[model samples]
Each structure stands twice: as structure tokens, then as C-alpha cells.
Target: MEINPAVTFKHDRSIMYAKRPKVLIVGAGLAGLTLGMLLHKADIPFEIYERAQEVKPLGSAMYFNSTTANFFKQCGIYEEFLAIGKYVSSIQVFNEVRGHEFSMDFEGQEAEFGANGYIVARPVMYDLLLRQIPRERIHLGKKVLTMDQGGNGVLLRFSDASEAEGDILVGADGAYSAVRQGLYAKLKKAKRLPSSDDLPLPFSTVCLVGQTRPLTAEEFSDIGLEQCQFRRTIGMEKMYGWATFTTAQNTVAYNVIQFLTDETSKQNDAFRNSEWGPEAAMAMCEQVKDFPIVSGDDKELTLGDLFEWSDKNHISKVMLEEKVFKTWYDCRTVLIGDACHKFSPSGGVGATNAMHDAIVLANRINGLPFHPIAEEIENAFREYKAERVEWVQKAFDSSKAFKTMTGQSFASKATRFVSKHMPAWLFQRIQAQTCANRPQVAFLPLHNDTGRIKPAPQPSLSVRAPVEAETPVAATTATATTTTTEVV
Candidate 1:
């Protein structure tokens, strides 16, 4: 991959104006790193602070939609991303009990939207973003203790008794954000805080995620890794699981999620503090060990099969949370990504949304003049939030809806009926239309026209019926095969 000279970091202090308002970004996650990269490319002065000692594989896999792919191409890292990630050509969903199945094809999405949805391990994506940023600009292990805003800028105090000042503060510190807490305290004191910002929304599902060791040819062939197809199995007793293979590593990553719908507050509290480790993950797997993922006449993949093939230490358990705050900014301090809106993993949009937030926020700040006034910065923040709030809410609702549809309930059954019976042409049409309407980075030019901005060609909503529905299977031992083709 050819690296862009303009996108590389340059440590030329002489080019920076002394009077310019420096940006103080909290958190070194996807949102913060992306914002930092944009600031670097635009020749703006900024610094990022992270509480962690270094970047680690904290999460499992993430899916980047067409919109995010465009942003990466603009950042001049799309080729690198392609080498690390796998493009998803189709998604298959099955009702484990009923044996009803549905598959959505994404054959023409790359040409229509300029890119298809790509999936990569979270740690790999984090490292890729980190590589584009200068190490000096990122400070690790500096946990923020408090924040104070003065007439000209904001002051930050760290846990190590260190202090820093900046003209603008950005809180991309994720859901449990200290900056958000500080901003909320100030807002409440001024009687400007909304009631929704007082507490986090409760999450009821527990997820165990892990990646298996490299698979042999037979093992890989049985799992059917064609353009990295995503398979989701909706089983009995509110158990759901998803599986996909990583191209670069030749490993299969899977998530086993169980929904705790009727648990009391006491049980929830106990579960929250429960020790999560390999034992817990294996215990969860034992409960659904026999749950069928892909069943054929001679081949069957189950939860226990994948668990047995995984590295014990790599397995992790986490409770999924969902929320979208009513407030995103308070004066000079603004929140992004999970800090403002968090999504359940059902839709695989959390990281994508975070990346989008970075692009939009960077565009707004990039338009500001050097040494922008407080009022000017505030207006830019407002515009950023106003442009993003509706889309984030829509994505949040969609994720929740997907979670409901993939569960063992009346709604889930109804959704299965629709999914099983929906025509392939119709599904493709809807997907194409959705992809066509996806948002783009307003400031970045199209991939082909890197030197100038060109309006994206409006894709036609024409649908093709290339994907065929397989016959429903009644016997557990019967084989159900779906044809696979490379779309990328």
C-alpha cells in the first residue's frame, strides 16, 4: 500500500501558530485516534490522552459499513485496510429451532456505494489507526481527574497531579467518560442538564466472544468462508450466536450471546460483579454446547466445537449496553462516539458510528479559523451535534430492533417469518437503497478524485434476484447448502 505523503505526520513546530487554540482530546480509542489523524492531516495542533498503558485487543471484531470505508479511502489507508480486513459478501440468518433461514446478498454494493462492508478484529483496526498518528501527540496512562473551563480555554487535572490547558476539550473517552461526568456536574449546577444524562441505560444480554486457532483446510471448508460471509444462528431459550472468519489470520471469531430478559435487579447486580474469565466463557458454552450453527448431512458446527478449538485465554465475557444521550456538548467540552451514543453489538455499527463521529467533528473543526473564539467553537460544536444526532438515534433504534428480531420471543418469531418469506429481489432492493443513502465525509474527496471534490453518483435502486433461498430442513441431520461466490 502506498502511503500518502500529505497524510503522514510532520513535527514542524514552526508551521503552528502560537495563538491558535490547541485541541485537547481525551481517550485514544477509534474516535480520538481518527480525530487526531484528521487534525494532523489538516495541520492543526492537538493532543490525545488515554488512561490505558497501551493499545490492547480489548474488544472482538467490528464491521465497517460502506460509509466508513469511504472515510478510510479518504485517509489514504484503504489499501492497508483491505489487506487487514475481509469484505462481507452476504449474511445468513437461521432460526435454530424452526430451521428457517434467510440470506441477504451484497454482490453489487462495492460498485454502487464505492465499497462493501468489511470486518476486522478490533485490535488490528486500533493498531492501524495508531500507526498514522505521531507518538508524541498521544499520551497514555494519563487518567483525567477533573476538568475546569476558564474564559479562554479548559484546564485538565490528571490523576498523577499533572495539569494541562487547551482551547477546546473533546471527550471521546467512551461510555464511562469522566469528562462527561464533569460536564454533567457543571450542567446540573447551571440547571442545564437534561434528565436523560443522569444515568446509563441498562443492558440485559451477556456475551462471550473468542477467536479460534488457525483452521485446517477441511475445517475452514466446512465453515464456508466465501468473502467472509457472516452467519447468525437464533437458537432456543434466547440464545444467539454469530460466526465469521478473518482472512488475514485464517481464524474464526464467534460470539455467543444470551439474553437475560426476566432477571430481577438483584440477579442483575450479582451478574454484573461476577468474575469473567475462561471458566465463565466455557461454562456459558456448556449450556448451549449442542446448539447447531451450520448443519449438513456430514458436517455440523456447534458452539462447543468452536469453543474447543479456541484459545482459552482469548475468550472474554461482557455485558452489552445501549444508549444515546440527549446532550453531546457543554460549552467547550464535547462528547463523541460511545460517550454520546452507545449501541448493542447486534447491528455491528458501534465502531462505524464512532469513526463517522470523528469525520464529522473533524470537518467542523477544520472549518474554524485559527484561534477561534469561544462562541465560534461553540457554534461549530452545536452544528456537529445537530448533524449527527438524528442519524445516531436511527442507528441506535435499528440495532435494538435487530436485537429483538434475533431473540426467542413473539417478535423474533414474527421477524423470522418475514425474513424467511421476504423475496431476495426485494431484500436486495432495500439494501441497495439503504447503501445509496449512506452519509459521506463532507470534507473528503472521492477516492478517484483525490485532488478535487466530486459529487457521488446517485445509485439506481434496481434490484437483482441473484440470491436463491434454500428449502427449509426438517430433519436435524439433513444438509442445507447455499451457493457461494466471490463478490469483491
Candidate 2:
């Protein structure tokens, strides 16, 4: 495979040689795993610490837009991923009470952007990423207790009374990040912490997500073919909405979001800090048990029906928090993904943003000289933050706006009116403009020798060729070589 020269950085193979810094990453989620993959490609030593005993199917499902699809292609996992997901041709919006409907076609996106949006179960995606990296590098059940950084390096203390040191540390630990909290605490004691990092944006919406067993042909037909389409149904009020998507795995994933409009601090606290478990999730489902899941062809499937079809153990409920923090790094410590900027999941771009962070940050670090000093590492962190902040803020705002426009508010009504009345071509044009501005992985090779990292050979698995791959290659041999290299 030829590498694209445009994305490669030129550097002497051997100059000022020093031992490459080891990175200690907290959280083995998407962001952490991606960073590890990039570092592995660059021959940088790193380790990942995950609090969970093992990686499991925890979340409902995630969507990958063109931007994310391109990144996966670069990583050599696009074909495998494409085989697991269902390509979303269009998105349909309906109002149960108002009897309004609209559709946005995404089929043209494939021609313009190389791929359309695809949806897959969260676990399937996680497994694909996990398979690319060596299992020894990941440490499970390792909860990060605290971290301290000094002139030499960063020291991490784990809950199991173990300690480790690394040249740099990254906190990819999700919204309630312990690394972010630890860094903030240290800065606050020194009286240098910013006010914005003191608290996260308040959340008033609660969500329940679950996946149903594979639907039989008869069951699927009863709900209409629209059930197989990406669909969102708005409620009569501004505070409620639900979305459903059926994947290639034959499972149906659904999300129910209800916004609290009471405007009371108690109500906010109750929902935000609410304990979520199987019982709680089922209880919430009972509240709207009769709510329509999909209504068409004189047939209606309710939330209760979906819940009844899902395993109780797979259901989860939680609050949706949205915010972009003012600070992302301090000294040898930095943050990525939901640890810094969290989205409302309305636009389905949060995971994509996380993957983007991994690429940008890795590229910045890869640009540094071999065995860089602390100053050089800090400079890389600064550059990474500078490149990402604006884009992240934009995505954050867009997601919030999307959530609002799908509700029962005046804005939602206006949005619905335009969507229902607009021509399909106009919608496609608007979507094209949005995709044009979407952020892509930069400073990385895409086509030639410098573009991607090939992984070590693994056992054979069945996977189809990516839509973009003209000549199909065996899955086992196709992803066997590392495509990118770090200057040493």
C-alpha cells in the first residue's frame, strides 16, 4: 500500500536520541484506546488503566458520520466496522400528537463525502478497537485515585495501592473525570484554577436507553418498514422525545429523553444525582409505558413493548450533561473526550469528537522530536488544545441546538415547519454545507505509506471490503502492516 506523502512529517531517523516518553492513560474507552493505537503506531510506549473489570456492552449504540468513517478508514478498521453496522440512508422525523412528518435523505452523502452515517452497537465498535491493540497494554480494574506531576514526570496512585510513573498522563475518564478533578484541586490550592472548571453545566434532562432482541420478520413488518429506518418521534410537549434505529445485527436500539421544565433546583438535583439501575430504568419506562414507539399503518408500538422485549440487565438511565470546559491541560496532565467537552447526544457527535481529539493530539505529539523534553511535550499539548477548542465549542453548540429544535418549544415547531415544507434538495444542500465544515483528522497520512498504521497479524475473521476499497483484500492480510511511523 502506498502512503500519502502530504500527511507525513519529515525528520531525521536518528537525531538527539533520547528514550521516548511513556504515557499513562486513564480510562480504556474509545478515546483512550484510539490514543494508544496512534502511540503504538509511532512506537511510543504507553499503558491504559480502566476502572471496569472488563469491557462490556454498556452503552446503547453510536452513529458514525462521514468524518468518523474517514478516520476509521485511516485506522484500517473501516471495512470490519462497515460489516457490523447499518448504513443510514435517511433520517425520518415524526410528531405523534401533531401528525406531522419529514425526511432528510443522506444517500447523496456517500458520493460527496465517501461515506454516509452508520450506526452500530456500542460493544461491537469497542471490540473492533480492542482487537487492534495488544491486550497486555490494557490494565483493567485499575481505578485512578490521584495524580501528581513534577519536574521529572507524572505519578499516578491507584485504588489498589499501586503506583506508576510516566512522562505524561491523559484523563479520558468520561464526564466525572477523576484526573480533571485532581488537576483542578491542585490548581485551586495554588490559587490558579479558573472558575469555569469549578462545576459542569447543569443538566435537566433524563434519558433511558435499551436494545431489544432481534426482531422476527413478522414482528418487524407489524411496525412498518419505518422501524428499520432512523426515526425520531416528538411528543406533544417540548420536554419529551424518543429515537429508534435498527442495526444490521437485527437489534433495535432506542432512547427516551425527557426534559424537566419545572426550573427548580431540587428538581434538577433529583434528576442529575438520581441513582440509575435496572429497577430505576424499568420504573421510568413504566411512566411512559403506553407512549408510542413507532406509529404508522394504523399500528402502534409503545415503549412498554420495547422494554418488554429487552433484557432488563441491558437497560440504563442517566442524565445528559452538556459543557465545554475552559481548561483542558495543566503541566504534564491533559484531558480529552467527555472529560473536557461533553455533548447532549442530540446530534450523535460526542463519540466522533472524542475520536477527533485522539487524532489531533496524537499528530501534535508525533510532530515532536524523538525523546522530547518537558517543554516540547507541553508545547504539543498547547497546540493540541488550540486546534481543538474552537471546533469542540461549535459541536457543543450545535448539539444543544439540535436537542432544542427536536422538542415541543417554538423553535422546534419552526424547525418542524421548515423540515416538513422544504424540498429534499434544499435539505441535502444544507446537510452538504454542514458536512463541509465538519472537522477531520489532520496531519496524518490517508492513502500512501505515511497515512495509516498497520497492525500485527491476527486470526482470520469474516469482513467485507469497504465501499471505498476498489479491490477487495482478505481481512486478515489487509490490516497486517503498520502504515505510519514516528521519527526516532
Q: Which candidate's TM-score is highest?
A: 2
Provide the lowest-lDDT 10-residue window in model 2. 455-464
The clash count of every prediction, one per candidate, is 0, 11
Q: Mind giving the per-residue lDDT tens digits that candidate 1 earns over 33-53?
A: 989998888667899999878
- The C-alpha lDDT values of all candidates are 0.70, 0.72
lDDT agreement of model 2 with the native: 0.72
Worst lDDT run of 10 residues, candidate 1, spans 479-488
lDDT of 2 at 470: 25
Please provide, for model 2 over 347-399, each residue's C-alpha lDDT reduced to its tens digit, 9 standing for 90 to 100: 78888889878877776665544444455566667767766776688788878
